[model samples]
Target: MPPVERRDPEPIEAYLFDLDGVLRVWDGADLAAVEARAGLPPGRLGEIAHDLDRYGPALLGEVTDNDWRASVVGALVADGLKPDVAVDVVLDWSANLGRVDPEVTEVVAGIRAAGGQVALVVNSTDRLELDLVVLGLDLAVDTVVSSARTGIALPDAAMYEIAAGILAVPAPRCAYVGPHAELVAGAERIGMTGHLFDGVSGLRAIVETLSAR
Candidate 1:
């Protein structure tokens, strides 16, 4: 692995990661597929994904699968598609999606090689087992906390607490890497080091810097 830039050590002991935009790019492709299948114009998925009312609680684990399905169906219906067809199309789009970033995998490996515990905290409607299998990511991390299982998602302090509890580490010693500023901020609020990961190199640098602290 390439050497990550170093920084003075802080107090971080474990690492928490967000799956979608942070660790992979398949999420965008899935959204595109959903919009295309629903015959909607571009930007629909982006709008929904960024809509705090829609995605916030979903990321925090406050939303249920049924709620997600209903919301998706409603969005497609508003876009002039049939509800059942929308549901099916969304399911298909998500089911076919998988991770595409090898650098992320390498970073996870590097974290493990450094003797850091790694965990996944993601906003997912489907069971993580299917997604992990499709992406071949099951063995890459120490634990996977999906909103589907945790009943809470990012930006919610409870979710971070749950992740810390599961990792057997204190919140202050854990680090969270995510693409969303709000989510990273939330982790920071809970005493976890927050790193906004734009790519593998950036994340590797953050990890190395933290490790050295």
Candidate 2:
């Protein structure tokens, strides 16, 4: 990723970041076992995981956690699978919350130690915090702006605005960097310095761009 040019106002007061690709920085848990339990054809489990129509409500906090799990389990059972097998599949699916590169955590921790206020703004389900813990990442941020908790997803101006408010920082003084180009663009539209990270390596590029030279 090319270095982001610093623009307007002053050094950023807070940095709003994405989690999955940005912080996790790796292909997390393998879901092959979860698929096996559900007796799904290869790749079917991944498809269901990304089925927004099935998961959007859960991600938006419109459904309870158990209710959300039951939806997927129910679907599998209806697909000719036994009820016991369906529940087992969903239970196995929960094991792969995610994994984080400790190296990445150090980078964020370093930024925090240098006094950059940070907050995680991720589009995820209620398992976000659980995943964070499972990944062993000790995120030293002011607060997490979770779509599941806030009922607002990323790329929405309101999400970042609320995050800034929670961080007690001005909108323009906050910098947002994420993996999705659209989400970064969304942040840019509202005057926050927004950057798209290429991948794990791109993370350091981001830190350099934000550093005092």
Candidate 3:
């Protein structure tokens, strides 16, 4: 295959990124394991996992951790599992899953080497500091903004605003990269350039091209 042509970034000052599907691949294995332990069907677990992704973070803004746990437990109970079993299953599943992406580290390094500032903006229930330590992603990026800490998540616009504020750059001058189109759209809507990254090489090429431009 021919080399991918990259474009230079518009004299931008910094970069922002999303985690999960962008920097890391979260396979939802934890949710699957929880469902299996609860005796739920394969597809059923995926459905609940979708629901958690769709509603859990938003709900977190209004509910306590115990309340969120209760809600998940209640869903399991409705699916016919005992509440205690449901909670234990979920916790166990969560504990077993770990970060799977290492390419992100190189990409972050390239961005920094290019003299660009980078920050992580992720929608996560776990604390950013703890998760970074657990996943060992702290050395990859300059700063991290977790919804659990910022009280906002992707596609909300506020998360990007908060990130821009924290990075001390106008949103328009910052480039936001992620795998999700919605996040890209959100960045565009907020006046930032957005890149949908497929891998480190593609992302690095894009950044270099943008910088050259």
Better of 1 and 3 by TM-score: 3
The sequence of per-residue lDDT tens digits that candidate 3 reaches over residues 62-101 is 5544455556667777888877887786577546535647
lDDT of model number 3: 0.75
- lDDT of each model, Cα atoms only? 0.78, 0.78, 0.75
What does the lDDT read for residue 100 in candidate 2? 69
> How many clashes (backbone N, Cα, C below 3 Å) per candidate?
11, 0, 10
Off by over 4 Å in 1: 1-10, 27-38, 45-67, 70-79, 82-88
Q: Which stretches of candidate 3 lie over 4 Å from their true place?
A: 1-9, 28-34, 49-54, 57-60
Candidate 3, clashing residue pairs?
6-209, 7-209, 7-210, 8-209, 8-210, 8-211, 8-212, 8-213, 9-210, 9-211
Q: 21-117, model 2: which lDDT tens digit per residue? A: 7777544236765675556887776666557888898889888666777888777777777989877887877655566666667777877888888
What is candidate 1's local distance difference test score? 0.78
Better of 2 and 3 by lDDT: 2
